[model samples]
Target: MSAAASSPASPAALTSSSRLAWLDALRGIGALAVVAEHMLPWFVPSLRPYWFSLGVYGIFVFFLVSGYIIPASLERHGDVRAFWISRFFRLYPLYLAIIVLVLALAWWVPVREAVVRDGSAVAAHATMLLDVVGIGGVADTMWTLSYEMVFYLVVTALFLTRGHERSGTWAIVFAVAAVLVGLVASGAVFGGGWPAYVSCAVFVLGLTGVVLGRLRTVSACLLGVMAVACLLLSSRVPWLGAAVLAVMFAGTAIYRWERGTGPLWPVAVTAALVVVAPVWAIESGWWWVRADVWLTTIALAAATFAGGMALRGRRLPRVLVWFGLISYSLYLVHHPLLKYFVQVSGDLRQAALPYQLLMTAVALAVIIGASALTYRFVEKPMQDLGRRVSRRCRGGLQGGGEARVPGEDAGDDRVLGHQERQVPHGVGDHVGQGDTVG
Candidate 1:
């Protein structure tokens, strides 16, 4: 055997895998929660729990992680163009692949009714603003991508505006907006396909401007406005979308406090406001959004994240970390895979308990196995290429790097085992699996 394989892992190798093992552990847990959330209903309804939506809880965990780590991904590299490049390759390839997969399988597994066929779906998806624009995702879980993309746009703009440090302020702003919109808005305020159409154009144009270095700030600003506008005017519930964004920024605020660059109070305020945003929304009917249930889910998700942070220095289980590496794929592929199973195998809910358990095991194994393969073949290669491309553009966007704090290194790409690029890939709250899949 080679010496490299014979000896114990070097300190550097251990550091690479163990430093952010906690984050990966969280990702793995959240993805599995979502998978179980979707899977139990189809294969074994009796096994499904009714307290808090597993999907919602899992999504919240994901949002928190993304909020915490994304800024570091941007600042560590210190470049706007490269940041976007890395993000694009991180998400879009898998995202587009899922879309194609869904369409091709649409004949076997019926597409969700909310998915528009009038070209609007394509437009909404182009911006990853599918749910916010009143269009359905190719996969139900993809609605979360809209908000993820929005957060990225807003963060990019803030980084360029020298306002990146004001994470708490933005968190509060969105929290307040969520409540205000929840009170006054009813259903989607922006109707028709125009919002998707217009936003798609802006999305493309803004991204181009940001990348090419011509009026990049203005471009980012436009993208930011487009993002916020879609959230307020086009989401299924105005407050829900706003509150989700608030959760992401609240994650950022907490991160700032950890870096000693900010105070801890903003997180408290944002949390309070987000808790209240959907309580009295005009569209509030779902039992899951009841103030009590929502609070419980949010609190639990927060606690899970805190627990992970507390354990950050310790070596986590290797299986969990591997699950995290394939989490994005697991999250995206599981729902469609479930749909196909239901369609082909018929509902297993009536099957004997032993048979149901056996089927669930087989289905989960298939989902995890497929996810691992995709992560290896697709996500890993693209992420590697993106990092290389980003390295060449080091020092960051000509204007954006100034906002990154001096002497405050947020992450080590190698030390984190390339998990930084995986931040945006988790969770989408399409009201969980019982209602919708995303």
Candidate 2:
């Protein structure tokens, strides 16, 4: 029987196949775009005007993919304990590894100390709620992880409330709210001492909700409140943060429509709103507006997602698939690698164009190689351990009986094995699955 048959809550059966090659390819492409967005400006300043903020495009694509895949994962499992277990194993190992490496490197590099000073670093490490608490990330790239965590909480709320199918409607609501708030709000909604306290409270309450799965409805409502509050009130850029969430839900809406779980109109409306929201949210005469970068980024992200949908069943290149496999590691490790490289090598903007390009290429190669090792040694092993632990936990919960939904275990063992081993791919929330980078 397939893992899903044996454990009906496991989405691994759906996610592990080669059928999702297009999504994997999109992840690989996004990973490259993010790396370029960060590395290019340093090496080719002149090109910065045109390619500035390409990271925005990369992250938008990441968020969309995350929105599409993560909810499916949660709903498939239909068990909060299993879902959280998968996520913890998928995300934390590599994340903790990177943080430790960054801190250790900081000890030797003066420039790195900025990440460790004050209580901010400790808070970030302790909670992973740093950005929501109005404290900066230990590494600049970590800000996205905070948003990813909130997305997970919000998804959990929807799941518990049995309202996940209405994701498209939520997308529209968030987008509209973002526009209105952008126009009227002069500053952050909770820009005071309350942010940290509120963040901590939400974190504690969210954990409690997960643990007390019997009170799912109440837990869901509480999580929803916390998530919405954090997004609207505590974010450094509430409008953009809300817009990002909308875009992610828009992706989720699209997935629901494709899977026959939702109406198409919401998806259509959400796509339209998301395309315009970022542009609308920006203040007039901002650099992004002046350069028309916002429009370009949105357009590129939309096109990429659409193309992936179009080519959903086709096989992608092995290299691209490999890139997707290690994309999360790439996202996590690349920024610090670039930071340290630039710090050690000094500014290379004054160098010849060829030399700058050469250095950029070298930096990318190193990051990729390092990512491969980490994926093999860290990500894969930890995920396997998570799977085993989840199996044990499920067995215990069910009094040693097979924990499965009815009638899902008739599949052939070979097919089940293939399905079970498929790695869930995406970026935005879970660094390995759909998490963020710098």
Q: Give the residue spans of candidate 1 off by over 4 A.
A: 1-17, 281-283, 395-397, 400-405, 408-412, 415-438
Per-residue alpha-carbon lDDT of candidate 1 for residues 1-438, written as tens digits (9 for 90 to 100): 443344333333334455468788888888888888788777777877666767788888888888887876677667788778888778878878888999898787778887877988889988888878888887878887887888999999988888887889999999999888878887798788988898899999999999878899999999999889988888777787898889889888877777656776888899899888875642446766766777887889899998887777687889998888898888778888877776767667668999999988988888889899888988889888887787677655475434443554433575434443232222233333345332
- Clash number for each model: 7, 7
TM-score of each: 0.90, 0.83
lDDT of 2 by residue, 1-438 (tens): 332233222223353454456666777877877777667666665555453356777787778888887776665555666666767787888889988887788665443332445554565555565556566555567667766777888877777665676888898998887677677764466754456665666666766666545455566567667767877877666777777788888888877666555655665676566555544335544444333666676778888988877766566787886777777788888888877888766677778988888887888888899999998999879877776665555432311111232323312121111111111111221122121223
| Pairs of residues clashing in candidate 1 | 78-396, 79-396, 79-397, 80-397, 140-438, 141-438, 430-438
Best by TM-score: 1
Pairs that clash in candidate 2 = 9-77, 16-422, 427-434, 428-434, 428-435, 429-434, 430-435
Would you list the C-alpha lDDT of every candidate in the order shown?
0.77, 0.64
Clashes of 1: 7
- The superposed Cα distance between candidate 2 and the true structure at residue 105, in angstroms, equals 1.6
